[model samples]
Target chain A: MATQRILDFLATRRPDGPCLVLDLDVVRDNYNAFEKALPNSKIYYAVKANPAPEILRLLAQLGSCFDTASVAEVEMAMNAGATPHRISYGNTIKKERDIARAYELGIRLFAVDCVEEVEKIARVAPGAQVFCRVLTDGEGAEWPLSRKFGCVPAMAVDVLRHAKALGLDAYGVSFHVGSQQTDLVAWDRALADAKAVFSALAQEGITLRMVNMGGGFPTRYLKDVPTAQAYGQAIFDALSKHFGNCIPETIIEPGRGMVGNAGVIKSEVVLISRKADNDNVRWVYLDIGKFGGLAETMDEAIRYPIVTPRDGDAAEPCVLAGPTCDSADVLYEKAPYPLPLSLTIGDEVLIEGTGAYTTTYSAVAFNGFEPLRSYVI
Target chain B: MATQRILDFLATRRPDGPCLVLDLDVVRDNYNAFEKALPNSKIYYAVKANPAPEILRLLAQLGSCFDTASVAEVEMAMNAGATPHRISYGNTIKKERDIARAYELGIRLFAVDCVEEVEKIARVAPGAQVFCRVLTDGEGAEWPLSRKFGCVPAMAVDVLRHAKALGLDAYGVSFHVGSQQTDLVAWDRALADAKAVFSALAQEGITLRMVNMGGGFPTRYLKDVPTAQAYGQAIFDALSKHFGNCIPETIIEPGRGMVGNAGVIKSEVVLISRKADNDNVRWVYLDIGKFGGLAETMDEAIRYPIVTPRDGDAAEPCVLAGPTCDSADVLYEKAPYPLPLSLTIGDEVLIEGTGAYTTTYSAVAFNGFEPLRSYVI
Candidate 1:
């Protein structure tokens, strides 16, 4: 749920423009809930999802390990009071300079999928605790992860062995089931793949112990996703089934699930005119769109639950768009949303489950729109 | 064609990261050429296309008015030494505050599609020169832009009437044939639509004066486009055919066509590894991707002419991707681009015709990566 009381409170106070509201209290509760469910698992919060300073500060205070994809994220983790030991450079495709800089900033843990990246890490951060990201089919996921990352299981074993030869810590394997992954079986399948890689590395006499299950845990959006407890149980079952209950020091990187529900975006409806007299598609133009903060609306891959203030009025299917002059700034064009017919100019359109990818994906200066602003309570 | 000598010079000088290089001299040439072709048409350079200070400054020096989409763009135009009277607030969806601010900053002309925006503008910018943006089919464009703007021609007349009633200048009719429109027939069709609106508005005694044929002029990309002179001739012939010799004062908003060819992005080939032994698809990772600067590759909409070092080797079809850890960051996963098999890490990939919409569309902190850097030569 969006916690209507908080949203109502926020709308009354802030009226300048579109902004994301983040609640640290909700963050703390979500963190504790995840921690309680998976007691043995280390929570490495992915910084790329929502790297708000206050959010990172709260997570850092919660003894959260950081999963950083870039040098700036590593530095952000450190600046948020996380020691280098708590930050893992999880990006496989990184420049050698970024790798070296992360190492200089005291980050020792890195993730790599290829032989070349392993060599770069070895050259930059020798003896770094590096893990091989193994490939999975990314089946039954909304945002499929089969492309753009990971190596095949057979190649992953060699990458790990090569890591050991290059004076690097050949830590365990990692895999992602893609972002907002709907299917629970995907985790089990990925865990099994991780186990296969682990077994292959063990056969080579290279004892790897760290298993980083990369971020895929879905957050509550337009649809009700499987809860954190369900994910936790599935993860636990997968770990037990794969490792025979002798689980490695398991790491779960939760980016969206940790902060997604805790935030809401408040945007005003700029125009709510039907595109044409005969046209049924009412174009509801909002101040924010793809270039503003809703980049995940690409093909409607991630649907943020939207709510208007005028709820009692009859609803009509409306195509929503952002304020930018670009034709591509439309949010929901194909899918005509049933918005309240009473919703008009200046009416609040609160977007829920928008914390994670919203703020970080905005195109700065796109059509002269300011960067997406976020406020924490 | 790209100035290869300048590109070679840039690659030799800048080896730090991916950069979009803007040639101000080229911008000046393109501007002069367009003005020479369409001597009577007022050129309002769309600031959203590039918004580089140097580029804006050069255009401003060449006596170009700016078509501003947002408050920041209006301010950018002002900062570039453009008078407020010279800046037309072209974005239909805008905050009331932004309208007031623009009015306060002395912006007189504004674009509107619906009644709500017209009313809002009348309230904030009373007696402002308001243009009615009438809708068209937006046909035959490379990047089709039917959604997010304009109203029916019938609604446009009412909108203009309403604007006049509210003490505003009901100025004109505008229709975009979308960006990078391939067919010249789209313009003729849109011009006919504008003529209809013009006749309708003239009968209503609104006397709309400007025919704002919104931007659709294509720039050179991977494929060759019709010359600007060809577009100017078509536009002139269309105006003569519709409005006759006594046509109203015209305004053309050229965003991409004006600045796109003046820029090129030089990005380093980060990594290239065969995805699988049997799979012929090689994954070529670049320092820049969709989020970094190439957001137009959403569905491979904008194909830049990519040139790499070590040409003439055996060509292999490779899938290009950005450096982000996100799996969705694959740039050309579906479109397997043929590149030199000898291409390796740190090799330069010079992307031509990337000047417009490149630097302005970058996500600021996407995965902790730096914003797309742009250098003006």
Candidate 2:
């Protein structure tokens, strides 16, 4: 995709203020790359990343399933032509009305993480196919999911037994290592626990048809982070070895890994001020804030690269802030300040790797700022 | 305000989800305290904190000035019955159209931080009353506003001189020490710098009419922080001593100090899971995320207390997490686990100190979650 095309498109359409640009070419390439790494498994595009109806429609055209966590997400997928059987309502905290709505809408593949949730689903959607979420022992993982919603392996087996007693179909097992997970060994450990749970359920005359390796595939942000292909292959090999024949189907929900770097939040440099404590270090304020694309990185103590429209060699370090009055409106700190380009007040700065949570999860209509505008390359 | 009455009102009126319950009684008390402490200064309620129309109406009733940072904020204040002359368009990086709109709407007071901004405002709001924002030399302040929008003290005088030449009224000097500023000595140093700027301007035969001191009054969140009264009194004393009889009319803009603790974000507990590494620890998940009530505390590395509906003996520490898929959704780590007394599946938890930025700034409609419902007491 031509960068100038997007720039020109935005300049023509959303010339009033800042806008987020999504690159469909990069998104399709990311989806194909992940599919290539896990050739045998089904790729459930996590619509929580960028739930633009057009993006979801494109993924559906590419033969991708969806992992929806809410009724709204489910409806979004359905609107994009995703069949109920092809979607998984994977969130554990199932609202009673939402569960009833999903069941009425024919969404049967529900993910449950606790005994109480299993009972709730059994009461609401007795015919639903449940995926018992198992807790992984992520002792050294970067982002551990077991701390919040999943049940223990033994408890998961009990949940499966409860589902059997309630005459509900318990057909699969799932585990999320965590979001932005950096360690491949954590996948290996989670797979081992999943296989153990599968065998234990089999001993009780319950056969599992699918094993869902929940999405935590890391997206490339910093140069040192591992690529998506590297992480996908590691999980694919582990699933192949552990649950080779027992599980005929596998589903992977890759949200950020597939779309995080495919979009950029383009904003204008509104103000620049030199720091009084350090004259060399200046602060650049953009026309956006924590309410905009930087919402995901808020308080995460992480930094994203800020690139100016023009390139130069005289780079310095500067703190990047947003236009909001709140003190927490900073976008990046101590970022490598771009060199003096042939740009002035209205020049744009493209903040990359914001595709995942930038638009679908964080943009608000506060201060009358315009919502994100998208384009297909 | 009666907490029980407010709770009952919200239970009936608030939408079925995570929402904010704003109490105007507490806000009135806060406003009066700040007004009493700075008896001589004109108080401007920063609308960026909680810009709900009801909040603005209450502040207007209290005879406070309106400090608007955007055109929408200015419109909100005006819609709440504030005269344009009582409103100050105080943002440093403003669009040309917004400036033009403010000028057309008859807003007189404006803040200018740089030479470019002065030129822009001159072209847009030539009849506006302008104040050159000076960067203070006081380091170690809690929230430094100079890092993003203000000019150095020496350069500020030059900008003021230019503002006078551009056929605009260079009214006086203004400086923001920072948000949630706790250091009294920093205010002393900033006041001293402002006095020096005042003397230099006076020598040039510029009789200033207003010395606007930007807001940084600390709100009560953690116990160790000083009260708003202490900070307000210190500022008043510093300004009176430095300028003596030649003091210009004092102006202050308080955002969080007036409304930070005046509201509570009430959410229901959906799911709970114990940590794998520590058997004694558990994690309680709420429907809100970092995108909701916890937006202000982002990256601050601070924890807020969570109060259960039915108080009980504190159990072991449990981490509180949000419904977002990100691992950074953890709201409080090692929070004293309030015993789940009478707290079954759908019990409510009150998260406080969310009145400031919770709704106006961070409540994104993610996962189909609508913005919060507001009720004034």
Candidate 3:
């Protein structure tokens, strides 16, 4: 939802071309909600979601730790007033040079999914705390993570043992239920895998002390999703069920959930017409597309709520597309999106729930369109 | 195939991180080949494929016209020394203001697929030469363009008629067989559709003079494709078979065919490990992935040939991935790519046949990695 503040900003600035307007006020509130919901778990704000300097500064001021994917993000968080201890290099895939660079920056926390990555960290970032990510089924996630990442739980035991052997702190286990995850039980299943890794490691004389529950928290898109409070309750129950009274230190990395609903992309209807007069479905072309942003619309997943000025009028399903010359630029066609029947050319529409995963996914001058411009106020 | 010049440049420059290195000599040769193949048709280099200023300058100096997708691209073409007459606003979807801007910039040619787009051109870019794009089956293309672009040939006739009535030049009919089209007969089918539009319009006393054979040229990837001579002969035969020697003014927009094989991307293998000891497939993580610049690997459509220093060693199938934290960043998984068993971390690999459609598709720092840096020699 576009906050009144964001709407007001758009009304006043009247920015040219398609751009993303993010509300810091909304981001601040979302951060507070997550903190309240997960009172015991530390919140590592996923920096890849949206690394706008203002958002990073606001999160730093609010005492949120950062989950970074690369050395650049680690530098961004540090530049935004976060100390090295407050940041975790969360990407399981990393170059040895990049690992060394982060280590030189005084960051000790790292993520790994294989013995090879653990060996690199041992050679470079000695004695760093490392967490092995366990694989998840990724059920109920709109943007399901594939097996490209995490190793299986059984492999996790071996990876952690290797980390301990290399003189690094075998931190804990991590798993992602997948991005835009909706089912509450998704966390319960992943937690069971994490607990198994913990038990196997403990029996081998290495006690893991943390469980980095990777980001999967949902953001409201076309439908209402579970609130932060609801997710927090579900996660806490899962932790208790798995660990009993010995709940280790926990961390929740919320990327989309933190800022997804906090921004709106204001775009114009570039064109609207039927393939033929007899064609019942209309094709609605917008200034923004997959390359411009809204890449989550790939595979018709993560359908964002579109707001048209003619909202109250009768609506019909229209095949939505982007302004790029590439055929892959079509955003919604398999499942036509319903828009007002009276929608015409040059009409402005706001794509909501776009704060997260919008700016970063934007291409650099694809088809001569500049990267998605963002204004954080 | 990387020419000796590109390989020599890469060997000498040794640029850090994944970057594209292009050879201008190859593009020049490609342009000459197209000219010899379709001697009667004007060559309009599709600017969206790879808008590198060096490539554009070479094409412009060689008297190549440009098919641009936006006002910015039109300006890029003009800045690269191409005159306004040599540029076509080839995107069917455009903002009315953008149309006015291009018109103000002295662009007199445009592309449209519907009456609504024509109406915009009528209001802002009056009397401009407008070509209506007709739908094609896109049958023999690896990247089959969907119905996102163009309309049925019958609707194209109406679109051109509407353009003529609106004081615009009903100049031509255009159809793209689809990108990376390997079948030489694909153009024959699409030309049949263009001929239908031309015949129908000629019956209504509108003498359309041009047949814009839109880009569908394939670049060699993993598999060898037909030569430019083969395509030209087939297209010429189709024209003779349809128009009976009274050929209309013709244009061929070559995007990929012009530069796809002229460039190569130099990437490093970041890490390599199996999910489990028993797991047969190695997960080979590269410094680049779908978001980084290999976006064509979505659905494993465009498989670029990988050149490893250890190419002669025993080979095994590997699940290739990018360095990003996003799980969707995996390049090839459905059909794993075979790589040298001796390939190791930090070894540089060359992704060949990637001169075009690489830089523009790159995300702007998806995980703090910069866009695919390109060096034209």
Candidate 4:
């Protein structure tokens, strides 16, 4: 749906070279859709997904809370008119000063998966509501998170108990199935693990009041994905099954799922060439790449839907890449897409469903290529 | 060594968080070393390596040529007092306007791999000197380049002939053994491939005056690498064997080799933790990661030597990661290094020999974190 909007926007704006078109209306629609889908759950837009002020302002107007990964994101949300109470410091890793600054900025709720993080928060922001994130399989997500965060159920229980000992609020438990989650069962699995941590915490005389189902919602890219409705039903069914009668107040932090399908990237084909005797494979270089904007193509784990302006059939296969000098800046090569053989330099290509992660993850000065320009309609 | 210099600089600057320190003296020494090694070869410091004005200025004053890949880089070199004659637009893929802009800026030397690029150059800047880059195996390199560039011998010959037909000067042939090349034989193989294209061009009665060996010079990171003297001798021997009686004027576009050893990254260990019951693998998260500045950790392909301030022996194996919320930001997992187990939050670690690709390849903002800031000492 965003493709048509982006096409219309491009027709009017005539923006040039690797531009990201973010529709605030579409963002609002996604927010409203999430609100309706998870009626009982609090929605915090993960600001790291797309920290654009325009998008944040629209979300703020809709009374959406924010999951801030850093002090900058907290500021971004606040500058967009979000109060500190409506923001949660979501990232587990933080410098002591960042924690102090976030506390000074009025953010009370924080998520930590390690003892050091909890200790830092306890010292800097006393009695702050803390959520201990439990480890997950991180399976079935297009962008599987690293084992960089989250702790085992036992570790989570210990960390939460430590938080209580350090005079911080032993508030809740959180988990991420991973980014761009596909398997609905992933939530069921992660929730079961979370419930064990909750039970273990209760056994240690700590009563948890909240649960954050960290974002992992998927978008339709290259393939038809489950709708937000399905995700909502799956989450509700899993929560009901896991928590039984003791269902606590719930929070859902949806980053890519909320805004992913709301934006489109308008990039131009820079060149198309066959290296040496590369008979079967043709390389189609775009003005955008890993550094440019399409970094979610991390190992082709998240494939975006392509829409070219050309009328001819896109029957010929070609390896796709970005314009940066880095070889890894390539978008796709092994699983080549059926691009039009007639496509050449200056032809426009629209990569759809890149609303999230594109603008935020760009490597600004990689190859002196300009950071992807964005317009919010 | 730059270690003592960095320590001295850090003693005074006291820069906190992750910082890239580029040393101008080290750059000058590197330039002199390369000059001494490859006496006959023209040195074009690949500007994409580290486009810092100080580094550029030092190289410019040393009478070095620049291998520019973008309009901005072309301008950077010129702003650093490098004339267009001393800058070769090395990137094969370029927009027509960029070609025109480069030409207008007085850059005559260009690199092209295909017919279309040649056509653009011929139309935009007629009779411009064009170098045809041939395909290489891209083997034995930490950062394996994309097949997005260069063509085979026959294809290169045809493209050069087409350039001649279009009134563009098909001036030379070029090849990249790949970046951070370890196996010295890779250059020999690539040079051999370049020879075929060169011989074919001569059969068409076209003489190539310049042969550009695109940058792939290695920097000592985690292991001992060959010296600039050794590389110079190897290149000379290879050129003598390949071209026999008539060797073309030589050019070496070194990015990492020239600057990689001259810069050091001072990053703080953000958090160090292990998953529940995971007594085996300790995780040491740094304020820097793939996005922050250590992007060469492409599947642990390029390992930078770590120098920590800990007095104890570094015998503990740990997974390294960036401070970003992305799961994929894990730097090293399987190939765990013996980082000191006592390493904790705020512990400063120096990643040495990271001058070239580190700053240039850093992502602008991945998790609301600032881009990698560099200080030239």
Candidate 5:
């Protein structure tokens, strides 16, 4: 559906109902931008972001590889027609069964952080190509993966050398810059770190065949965040220049950066009340709460765009909250929106940029709310 | 299962894997305490807190009313042998289908907050006993429900009059003191407000039959928070003094206060890493992340008790986190635990008080982690 048609269909629904309306036009545009930025590198649409089968199918049809974190995500991608060779199980925590399933399904590329994980993977699937995830010393990223999953530079070399000695193909080096990363320089630093690891592995007589720059490209939540294309280009350029002729096949996993902007939660304003102390301060409550797609608001303190469906003369600032009985169900504090000419009890509010973790990591049935319906344009 | 048996069972499983172990002994004890505290009042086990069917059955066996917020919860309670009169459909955001389902299933008591809701309930089940949810101006509660679903005090009276005028039995006044409420005085103040409303309704020739003091009793989180029994007795005493012989049948909805301490999440310590600059400060990452029961850690900035199964020697403080790739998945910061004489790669750590919203709310399939398995004692 076109954006206008999707909005119109949603507007016709009960104004005080909770629903997730996905805009495929913007999703395609985002995909194309990533493809354009890193022309040589393969873009793996991270299924962990928005794993709706329809969205996955669309990305698969667009010739994008899938970055699956779990067996379920890999199954979802495969069900969506993604080829096995195009699926990379990029999570560090590998249970023996999950590794066996991934290997049996022809998922060749696996991300390994610890020696125990690599050993487990080797036991399960000896032929699997593994990427030794290296921890960058670089700080000041939004969500550094080094704290939990990645091995240090010295440890990475040791792990890779051990993997090669054990007859497992240590195929690549992977590092996550971080989630919602604002600084593009972080990727350049991460790539430099990757190159150093690559050189170290070469001295240990291991041939690395892939350079996986794990997903953390910034999505536009607020205006100040850089575009995904600009972020992708910086990493692509750094990898190309650093490795020169020795560069392996490049892979970029774009999770939230791709889908976050393509979806909006269209909910009806169920209740509106003015604060007794400050009459000017209004709290507009929607039918969806923190249990719905708005769980991101609780996690990241992100306030998405709260907009009116129809154009209005002037926008007034108001607090937007979910209908659940929790005080923490707030979506935005004093968000500005176009005021309706004559506001009624059941006005509609669009919470935009909710495609990523909204449905994928939601608790829909807590207050007996239904799971959101997904559609493709 | 008894607490000891559950712990033993957890100790035997992938004693090194992440899992939630619910202590049925503590749960039953808490249920008995609530029954004793609210001797004259009907105790509704708010199923939203911990929606395990076994728990519902146990509560029902203990002669507790089931406070249902959705059709599924109602069905769960009804399947557990809770009668229609023992169930209260308390959620304000009632979809037409849900209301109709409740009516068909013989659910009698309905909590209405707005004019639309009143009309919706009347149209669906005209014979249902309706309660006008009055918004209280009580302060210092953790989660004030007035902001979401309650009608203003005056509007509540109007709603009652309107319902009566429409030939609907608007039988009571209800208000929530809020969740995680520390101040016991807030209950007294809210009850005082309820008494004034009851008197006003009586003067208008309306004999209100029920006065619901909605759930917000403190759980065993912090040292300062009161126990469920203490909070329940405080409310009961306040209501008894204020209403005397004119007191209606009281109702209490206790969600987290009942199930909060009834369960513990048993997880294996997957990785222990120290910051590069600070070797003394260590972070222990468990198999469970925010996608599991540790979600509350991010929301409330509160940590649960992290204990080892084996009785060890001296205790040491360390940061605990989940196994997911997200950095915000930390369960506790600087949490003290006994350092085992021989702590190795796969030591077990049990996180207590995760029974409420842990399993039901935070089971997102990230990184192929297995969903929690529940075993009743």
Candidate 6:
């Protein structure tokens, strides 16, 4: 939902060109909600979600740690007042040079999914705390992360052992259920794998001290999602079931859930017409599309809530597309979006729940359009 | 294949990060090939494909016209020495203000797929020459452009008539067979539609001039594609079959064909590992992935030819991926690319057939990596 402040900002400022306007008040509220939901676990806010300086600064001031995906992200977090100890270089696939750069930047914690990555970190960031990511089926995720990321549980155990042998701290295990995960128990299956790695390492006299539960938290799109408290309770139960009374020190990396609802994209209808006079579906083209910032709609996965002035009017399914010349620029086609029939060219529309995974994914002048402009209010 | 100049430049410079090295000689050769192939057609270099200033300047010097998608591209073409008369505002989707801006910049050629778009152009850029785009099935394209772009052939006649009614020049008809199109006969069906629109407008007493045969020209990827001469012959035959002696002034928009084979991206292997001990495939993580400039690899559609130092050695299929936190960063998994077994982290790899649709599609800084760097030799 567009907050009253954001709505007022759009009404008054009316900045031209498709831009994302994010309200810091909403981000503050979301941070508080997460802190309240999982009081024990540390909140490592995923910087890749929306690395707007304002959001990072505010989170830093609020005593939140950062989960960085690159050396640049580490610098962004540090520049925003985060200490080196509060940042973790979290991406599993990293170049040895990038690992060295992160170490030079004073980042001590790293993520690994294989012995190759572990060796890179060991060679560069010696004595760093490392976490091995285990593969998850991603069953309930809207975007199923295929086996592109994490290694299997047995491989993770070997990776952690290799890290320990290389004189690095095999401090934890991690797994991402997947992005936009809605199922409350999705973490249970992943937690079982984490526990398996933990038990296997313990047998070899390697005591893992923490479980870095990776981000899979959902954001409200077109449908209602469970609250952060619901997820916290489910995760806590899973941790207790797996580790018994020895629940390890845990951390939650929330990217989308932390910032996905704090921003709204203000766009205008570029064109609206049917393919033919008798064509059932109307074609609605927006100044923004897949390349502009709505890349989450690639396979029509993230159905963003669109607000039009004529919401009360009758609606029909429209084939929505971006302003670019590329055919892949279509946002919603497999499942057409039902937009108000009264919508016409030049009408302003607010796309909500777009605060995350948008600005970062925007191409740099894909069709001579600039990267999606972002304004943090 | 990496052009000799590009290979020499990479070997000498050894750019630190993943970067594209384009040989101007290749582009010049391609321009001449296109000119020789379609002698009668005015060549409009699609600006959306690898709009490096050096390439644009060379094309402008060679007397090639431009197909611009937005105001920025129009300005770029003009800045590169092209006059407004030589540049076509080719994208069908446009903001009314953009049309006015283009007109103010002295552009007159425009593309329209519907009456709504025509009305916008008519209202803003009065007396502009507009071409109505008809739909193509995109049957033979590796990247099939869906119904997101053009309207049906029957409706294109109405669109052009509406343009005439609005006092705009009903210039001609346009259609795209699709991007990375390999079929020689693909243009035949689309040309048939274009002919029907032209005939329909001719009967209505509105003389349509120029057939803007939009780009579908393929670039060599993993397999061989027909030559420009072959496509030219096929298109000429189709034109004669459809329009007979009245084959009006023609224009060809060649994006990928002009630049795709002119450049190569130099990237390093970040890691090489398997999921489990029994896993059959090796995951080859590269410094570049879908976001870094390989977005055409989405759905394993454009399988770019990759060359490594050990290409002739024993080979096996590897799951290729980029160095990003996003799971979708995986380039090839459904059909993994065969790589040398000797491939390992730190080995240099060259991604060929990347001159077009690469730097433009690169994310500004997704996961904190800068956009793909380009160097024109």
Who wins the lDDT comparison? 3
Residue clash pairs of candidate 3? none
Task: Assess every candidate by TM-score.
Answer: 0.97, 0.89, 0.99, 0.98, 0.84, 0.99
Compose the digit string of candidate 1's lDDT tens values, residues A1-377. Answer: 56765666685786578888888888898899889878888999999999999999999999999999888899899899999999999988888888989889889999888888998988889889999888878777777775678888888888899999988989889998888887888889998989898898898799989888888888888778888888889989999999996799889899888998888898888777765667877888898999988998888777788888887789988888888888888788777778888786888878988888889898887987888988877
TM-score ranking of the models = 3, 6, 4, 1, 2, 5
CA RMSD per model (angstroms): 1.8, 3.6, 0.9, 1.4, 4.3, 1.0
- Cα lDDT tens digits, model 3, A13-63, are 999989999999889989999999999999999999999999999999999
The candidates' DockQ values read 0.75, 0.37, 0.86, 0.73, 0.34, 0.87
lDDT of 5 by residue, A1-377 (tens): 12685677565653345667777777788899888888878998888788877788888999999988778888989999998999998877656777898899989888887676778778888878889887765455554543665767777777777777777888889888877677788878888878888888788677788888878876666456876667767776787789986768888888878888777777776656553323465666677767666666653356566666554645466666775545556766644433553444566667777777777566535554554555554
Candidate 4 matches the true fold with a TM-score of 0.98
Model 6: per-residue Cα lDDT over A1-377, one tens digit each: 89999888888998999999999998899899999989989999999999999999999999999999999999999999999999999999888888998899889999999998988899999999999988999999998798988889998889999999999999999989999999988899999999999999999999999998888898999889999999989999999999999999999999999999999999999999888889999989999998888888877888999999899899999999999999999988888899999998899999999999999999988999999999899
- Put down candidate 4 lDDT per residue, A158-198, tens digits, no spaces: 89999999999999999999988889999999889888988
Candidate 6 residue lDDT tens string, B1-377: 88777877887887899999998899999999999999999999999998999999999999999999999999999999999999999998999999999999999999999988998999999999999888889998999998888889999988889999999999999988999899978899888888888888788898998898889898998899999999899999999999999988999999999999998999999889998999999999999999989988888989999999998999999999999899889899999899999997899999999999999899998999999999998
**lDDT against the true structure, each candidate:** 0.86, 0.74, 0.93, 0.87, 0.72, 0.92
Q: Name the 10 consecutive residues with the lowest summed lDDT in model 6 chain A.
A: A292-301
Task: Give lDDT for model 3.
Answer: 0.93
Per-residue lDDT over B1-377 for candidate 3, one digit per residue giving the tens place of the 0 to 100 score: 97899889888988999999999999999999999999999999999999999999999999999999999999999999999999999999999999999999999999999998999999999899999998888998999999888898899999999999989999999889999999888888888888888899889999999999988889999888999999999999999988887789999999999999999999999999988778999999999999988999988999999999998999999999999999888889889999999999999999999998889989997878889999999
Residues B54-146 of candidate 2 have per-residue lDDT tens digits of 889988888989998888888889999899988999887787677899899989888987777788889988767899777764365444553
DockQ of 1: 0.75
Local error of candidate 3 at A147, Å? 0.7
- Sort every candidate by lDDT, greatest first: 3, 6, 4, 1, 2, 5
TM-score of chain B of 1: 0.97
